[model samples]
Target: MEGLTAQAAIVEAPGGEFTLAAVTIDPPGPEQVRVAIHACGVCHTDMVMRDGGLPIPFPVVLGHEGAGVVEAVGSAVEGIAPGDHVLLSFHSCGRCTACGDHQPGYCDEFVPRNFLGARTVGEGDIRRDGSAVGGNIFGQSAFATSALAHADNVVPIDPALPLALLAPLGCGIQTGAGTVMETLRLQPGQSIAVFGGGAVGLAAVMAARILGASRIAVLDLHPARLDLARDLGATETADAIERLSGPFDHIVDTTGVPALVERAIDLLAPRGTLALVGAYPPGGAISIDPAAVMSVGRRVVGVVEGGIDPRRFIPRLIDHYRAGELPLEKLVRTYRFAEIERAFAASSEGSVVKPVLVMPAVS
Candidate 1:
């Protein structure tokens, strides 16, 4: 393989220390694939990992929304080869109940393994040398210039597409689309209230549109996001979703802020459903009015990666992107890899919807 001059962002300490440095990547072991990352979407979860929300191994590589080309593959890997374009998702054990059922997003061992940043394969831990660093962040420490991901988890893409856009498709977009289509199963004309018009919220808006929701309302405080929300397909835009008073048939909450979650529950109409698609810090909990939920026969559900099977979802996304539907281009704003900290700042401030950090081309 070409000389691997991989770069990575290291979380040396919680909230206070994020360091970008050169790192050496090892060759893929059995069943692993090495990917030369072209783009990685700066996701909130990565930031949370830096800020110590998920208690990952220190100096961990933190990114899950990465798209790139396969540079190498291990002996046991099949159906994937060098030069294949791929996107990585949250890790899963293939034999688990959820994974066997094609819902790896629901794998029972998902949280501990993916969050702890442990290796899904290989003899010993891979790191930046000497220090105890963890790889396998989501089974693909994709924040680096390259990553070694489990081959089974890599979804191939046509090289004709830009890796920059495909990055977000891995998690954010898939989660939003899958939540409405697979998890909630919105009938032809049911209403959906989408809370928090960030990347995921706006994505839900588009996905609900694709599902033909009768009424799709986007709720968020940011005017710009609301504008984007409307562009995506939200029939109505609301700054305060709770102002609607009665709940709609479904609520998709992208804001893990407990207060907003509580408000979402309040807005549910009888027999309404709520889906929490965002990440809350460890120990984060929302207070619920059990009687209110019971009286209305309401249900609150959690969705991970939009409850999607990435292999199927990614290809569908590619088709949608080519078909003039999905409208994903409107969601992304790109930045250079060196500007990742700036990109993260813009994302955290809600100044940009989805700030993708593009890597420099290798010679």
Candidate 2:
């Protein structure tokens, strides 16, 4: 088989610069599959990697919000086959306690193994200079022409829907929805407050609506996004966080700023749960009112990748999008793969919501 040149947008180190470059992909060995990516989402995490929030080893592919077709399968893999449509999510070891408990995000060895960027498994998965590239970054690293993902991370998807639009379902969309659906599991007729109003926050808003929240309020610094929140399904929208004081049944803060997290908790009702899903800088911590927390019986929960298994959640999200209930397509701005630099710039400007990089045809 002829090898294909795989292009990956990678940052060489934590807090280092990044660029897109091509690399050669070897054939998949047993227990591995090579996916030709059709689309990869330029998520905030990509920016965070550039900013060094996540310590992904340099010279490693940085994308995880990915969807595409399986071009080749490893020998030992099962059920899923080549040509299967698939989406990739962050990686976790299945045998870990967290994975066993259905909390793979909290896998004990997940941080070092996934963030280090080389092939995660000791088995033959990646190769570079006769040395395997540390690849299992979140288990997928779906940013290249062909991503070598574990059978566990490469989830098969229905081929009926557009692949490009479905990429974000693995990360941001699932984050928000999972917070409500799996993490908080807020009951019906409850009230929820979603802060940020970007993709993650909007995802929370949409998920809350699906979960039947009676009162859903969205707060954002950007009025334009707040408007979109209203269009999406938010019962009320506010530009400033200070404008409202609430005892919300559930509060979701996708902003990592300490002050915002604190204020989000303040809005929570008695026995309310505050779900913080954003990435905070190293050594950063928030100060909450201990007295109020004790008196109000408030609890703060941190959500990672929206507390989900990609294989389980991506399908439901796709169904919601197909039905127009979770119309995530409306939030996306597609960019040609060649325009990746521009898309990254636009995402940073807060001008674009979800920027998807559509790979050119292989003709």
CA lDDT of each prediction against the hidden true structure: 0.82, 0.79
lDDT of 1: 0.82
Q: Compose the digit string of candidate 1's lDDT tens values, residues 1-363.
A: 433557887777778545788887877888788889899898888778888888687767778898999998988889999999899887888888899999998898787668887564452345566454777888887878888888667999888888897789988888888888888888878899988888788878887888788889988889998888888888888787546545588999888878888878777778889998878656877888899899979999989988888988788877877887787789899998878788889999999989998888866
**Strongest candidate by lDDT:** 1
lDDT tens string, model 2, 170-235?
A: 788889888988999989999998888778989988998988998999988887888899888899
Best by TM-score: 1
Note each model's CA RMSD in angstroms. 1.9, 2.1
What's the C-alpha lDDT at position 11 in model 2?
A: 57
**Alpha-carbon lDDT of model 2:** 0.79
Off by over 4 Å in 1: 1-3, 120-125, 129-132
